[model samples]
Target: MKFAIAVFSPAHAPSSRRALLFAQAALAGGHEIVRLFFYQDGVHSASANVVAPQDELDVAGQWRSFITEHQLDAVVCIAAALRRGVLNAEEAQRYQRPAVNLPAPWELSGLGQLHEGAQSADRLMCFGGD
Candidate 1:
């Protein structure tokens, strides 16, 4: 089956961890993930500046590695990212920001990408929502 996953929780949240585990299980089961949409606070998972404590798991790094290893399409909502101060190189330059926190393999896009993912995938699984 083809799946589209959308995560709405922060990187430190349990829901985010659950989402990652679920993705791994799905892949192990021979399922395909069409896209992973990081919405709202979930965009934090794509931030390269994230620094986890020594005892805590590096959720952002885990996400980056998993996405890259699987060659998955990971998209973060541009508006949400901007609102939460997560900027990529182009966005940082355009906004005159001193630094860019979001890294590669995670593209900053619009909600239209989420819609497209939903349309293209056989299932759309959403994790963490208020």
Candidate 2:
């Protein structure tokens, strides 16, 4: 099965973790991820500037590695990301933010990417309630 996974919850949330786990299971079961769109607070999961506390694992890092390893399309909603101060280098320079956080393995894109993924994928799974 081909899947398009859309995540909306913040990283470290149980729902978000469950979503990733589900994606892993799907992949292990011979399913393919056509796309993984991160919107709302979920965009933070693709932000490179995020630093979890010493006790917490880096969920974003985990996703980055997973997506890259699997060669899955990982995209973030630009509007949602900018709204939360998650900016790529160009955006950060344009906005004069202190730093550029979002990086490779996570592409900044529009919601249309999600729609395209849905159109192409066999199943569209919305995680953490979209």
Candidate 3:
């Protein structure tokens, strides 16, 4: 089955970990992931600046590695990312920001990307938020 996963929580949140695990499992099971959309605080997962505690699992790093290794379509909501100070190089330059926390393997897009992903996928699994 093809799936589109939407995450609305930060990397530290349990739901974020669950979402990562779900995606990994799906891929392992030979299921395709059309897209992984990160909205709201979930954009933190795509931030290169995020540094998990030494004792922690570093869910964000795991996400980065997983997405990179599989060449997954990982999209972060631009609006939400901007609102939370998660800026890509282009966005940081446009906004005159000094730093870029979002890197390659993660694209900053709009909600339309999420909608398109959902429309193309057989299932839309949303995690976190309320």
Best by lDDT: 3
Worst 10 residues of 3 by lDDT: 121-130
Candidate 2 lDDT tens digits, 15-117: 6777789999999999999999999999888888777788987787788888889888999999999999999988989989998888887889999999999
Q: Model 3, residue 11: what's the lDDT? A: 90
Q: Pull out the clashing pairs in model 3.
A: none
Instruction: Write down the RMSD of all candidates, one decimal each.
Output: 1.1, 1.6, 1.0
Task: List ranges where model 2 is wrong by over 4 Å.
Answer: none
Q: Give a tens-digit lDDT track for model 1, residues 9-119.
A: 988888898999999999999999999999999998789998999999998899999999999999999999999999999999999999999879889999999999999
Model with the higher lDDT, candidate 1 or 3: 3
Quote the lDDT for 87 in model 1: 96
Task: Provide the lowest-lDDT 10-residue window in model 2.
Answer: 10-19
> How many pairs of residues collide in each model?
0, 0, 0
lDDT per model vs. reference: 0.94, 0.88, 0.95
For model 3 the TM-score comes to 0.97
Q: Candidates sorted by TM-score, descending order?
A: 3, 1, 2
Q: Write the per-residue lDDT of candidate 3 for residues 18-99, one digit (tens) a residue.
A: 9999999999999999999999899987889888999999999999999999999999999999989999999999999999
Q: Which pairs clash in the backbone of model 2?
A: none
Could you tell me the lDDT of residue 76 within candidate 2? 94
